[model samples]
Target chain A: MRDLVFRNLRGRPGKTGALVLLVTFLSLTLCGGGLVLSSLRAGLNSLENRLGADVIVMPSKAALKTDLDTLFLQGTIGPYYMNMSTVNKIGRTEGIGRMTTQVFLSSMRASCCSIPIQVIGFDPETDFTVQSWLAQSRQGTLKDGELLVGTKVNVNVGESIKLYNVSCPVAGRLAPTGTGLDTAVYCNLNTIRSLMAAAGALGGYSYINGDPAETISAVYIKAADGVNVDDIVNSINIHVRKVQAVRTRSMVTGVADSLGGVSRTVTVLMVVIWLLIWVILLVAFALLAGERKREFAALRVCGMSRARLSGLVFAEAFCVSAAGAVLGILLSLVLVRSFSSLIEGALGLPFLLPSSGTVAALATVSMLVCLLAGPIASAVSARKLSRVDTGLILREG
Target chain B: MDLKAQNISKRFYRKAGESNYFYAVRETDLELPSGALSVLMGRSGSGKTTLLSMLSGLLSPDTGTVTADGRDLYSMDDRKLSAFRAARISVMPQGRAVLDTLSAWENVFLNARIAGVRDESLVPRALELMERFGIPDLKEALPKELSGGELRRVMLCRSLLLSPEVLMCDEPTGDLDDQNTALVLDSLRDYAHQGHTVLLVTHEADAVSYADRLLQMDAGRISTPDPV
Candidate 1:
């Protein structure tokens, strides 16, 4: 039986080869699109998990942006800031459990640091955002001259980085967050204040320490358990002057809507390609049945039953489709792995490919769908071809 | 044992404005005895092939019954009939019985495989038949690569593989030359002499000379053999 199937496929290479290639293209589209969508979902989840703060309070004069990029964008937008006195006012709000202030400072490209990286300043005693995440890796607090680096920063722990004539030793590295924070550096308030004063003496003015009117970039607030988030957010907007409080839920939804649109488009395209492949297979098998009319008749006269003849046809289809499915899956694996970084750069979304178990499960499902399409298209033709009267065929031939 | 057809007839529907039914084979009674080669001769459209198809169970008669050894052949279900044919009967079709993709050897053993003979014991018998048919060296060649006579000889090997109890040949030498024709005729006669029934259908007059018993067909009816 196997010998017959192989010989038959080899006997008519043109039709068989065309069917195999069509199946391959269909499988590639399914597997590739599935992998990309899985990565996007995982990336989005990671970004949402990393935002531990419930509300972000920034100056009202700044542009209202809720995307993930805004959470860790390298440079401040036009240096909009409110006085540090607002921190006290926000901490006294009704549902606020913890409050902390973050100072934003940017390093120049040709400055003493030599690399333009985002510098974030956090108060060690009051920080509930960055300090909570760092506790998972290390238990100690940040000293005055120590810094924590993001995963993407090309610096090693214990190495000193020169920032605007002030140098600090790297304490530890943070895990990847799949956001702009993956490239930012973190330190206590004293370190950022000292760096700001040192750069000010060298003709560049960003911020000055010990000044009565010092301003901070944003305030991060964590709502207490059993507290209504909407109540706290509304209370802050009413009581805190010249500041706007934004909920993290609103930021995540802004990004989710865009991703949903992309996912829908991919699903529609996959369905269209599948329908095209099915139609082509039906036409090809119908022509093949017509061409092999006498051959089927001969088999019938040789004592081959109708059911056996149809089984042979289905077996042939299975062989070709299995080959094509395997090839398509292998090609998709190479393509997705090779261009993952570029895909992330192009979409401007944090992306992490799904785990190995998920990938294997998806590949198996796609290959099975592709492989079954061939047998389904040929079933009707098989029955029609087998039921033909051998007596008439012999006379006609 | 004997294979007999009793009061058998067949008719086809005519085109519009024509007669309602045209009889291809009129009601006829015939008996083909076991252990001898019986030759049925006729011209084209004389219903020789149609009658042969009825005898081989390829087609059912519109009227009456066909029986082998007192059991009705057409009374059995399709599954049992197919298995009976594969095990006890062999049919050699005209106009390229060999498949285009397989070599002569594969074509010969394919019958043995269909017969459910799983081992290589039939290999020697297949090769021996090919040698006797005078195409021993063409066993490895495809059907397309063989000449007309060589292909006919290969078909002969395929039919003889199962050593069937009843053998039916439909214009077996239709495309062969005189020499290959003599070879096929001699093999069929020898096979029948071995206590198996052989029925040969053809239009050529030369084939009548090799018949152990001759029956003539004209306009869907059979008559006694003409005097030599």
Candidate 2:
């Protein structure tokens, strides 16, 4: 069978062109779908892993869509103040394991490189998710007056950079995560408060001289091992007024659900494109089969069974599809890497370049589609060619 | 073994306006003995080619059976019949039916490969056949590049590649010069002398002068053979 396929493939004409088109289409779909789907999956996974806290209590006025958009899309920083007195109240509540406060601060800075950088301030000891990634870096931790920069930070180690009128040393650099982390800078919460204090913007600084308030923007609560996150969120929401506690699991699910409409749109568009391609391929192959009518008829007369003849057509398509897929994958990789920023800008979401697994899956799907299509088109052609009476023509000749 | 078609009949339907079915080949009986060259002579539009097609298992006879080596040709399914013909019989249809993409040698070897002969040595065999037919250097040439006579000889070589037990030729020497005609007839005689059954269908008398026997066809029925 392999020999038969090889011989038929070699004997087939117009194969190179067909192969090029097949691979082009497959590679584009695979690579495009891979990049988008993988990025979405990775982003959701990263968000889920990093939230660390089982439940987040925020102001009820904070809309879910607005908060998510601010956190992930616009990268906007929103501040909510609840008294530190509430922390003790939350700790004493049943089913609560541990609680830590976090203050969010962001600043856009243009350096010698001229690219704007977004800085984030958090408590190092309390921020478990950031700490985990930090531990993986060569320089393990961040110190007061020191900062951790992501892979795209573009600053040299130990470089002095001024943020909010304070010069801080770069302590460590993060690995490239192909996420928004690549564009972020991290510093301790104290440093952010100090900067705000110098600017007369710190809480209680105006009324109490330099005796700053120990208040935080948000508090993260970890649930007891046996506690259900959804139940905790519901319980907290019921007890606390004007505050909404969201579970990490529910947040991820909510985001995915919201993105469902976009996914559906993408899916419908992909299907329409695929159908168009199918029609085009059908016409192309039908004409190709028509042009080879004499050849197929001769093959029939030469004792090639209808099955084998159809197999030959399928084999040719398989070879073409395989070759096209390989070329498409290589092309897609280059395309994703080069155009990721454009895609991110267009979609208003983070885009990750496709991984090896993603590429393989795409190629496999493309090849399967091509293989299946070949036989269907060939069967249509084969039926017409096989039934042709060569007898009259042979006698005339 | 002898090739025989016993009272074979076939009727083809015309378009809706046509009142009757077209009788392609009706009650045609023919025979070709092993090591004998027999030609079915007829003009254009004659049912000679249709009869040969039925005999070769390319078409099923509506009312009779075709037998070779005492095995009924029409008894097997389409797949088995195709395999049987590919393995044991060779047909050189009118005109040069060589595959255009393959080289002369590859085209010939392809026939053998299709018949389940996969030896690399088939290359040499193809070359030898091409050399014997006086187109040795043309082995690597594409069929489109070959002249009419050269293409005809290549087709014959391809047919002979499997060393089929039965060799059927439909106008094997059509549109050829006297020299090319003699070349093809001589090759056919050589094939027949090697104990293979040979059946030739042609309109020209000179084309079948080398045949051991001759059969005439008129209106889809074969007359008794006139001894050569």
Q: Highest TM-score, which number?
A: 1
B16-98 per-residue lDDT for model 2 (tens digits) = 56777778778876778999888788666557788888888877778988999889998998789889988988898876576
Candidate 1 segments exceeding 4 Å error: A66-88, A99-218, A339-350, B9-23, B60-63, B219-228
* DockQ (Cα-based) for each candidate: 0.51, 0.41
The 10-residue segment with the lowest total lDDT in model 2 chain A: A202-211
What is the docking quality class of candidate 1?
medium
lDDT of 1 by residue, A36-140 (tens): 888778767866776678888888776646423565432223356677777788878988887888877767776587577777888989887787667766679
Candidate 2 local distance difference test against the native: 0.70
lDDT agreement of model 1 with the native: 0.79
Interface RMSD of each: 1.4, 2.7
Q: Report per-prediction Cα RMSD to one decimal.
A: 4.5, 4.8
lDDT tens digits, residues B134-155, model 1?
8889878988898877887888
Question: Candidate 1: TM of chain A?
Answer: 0.78
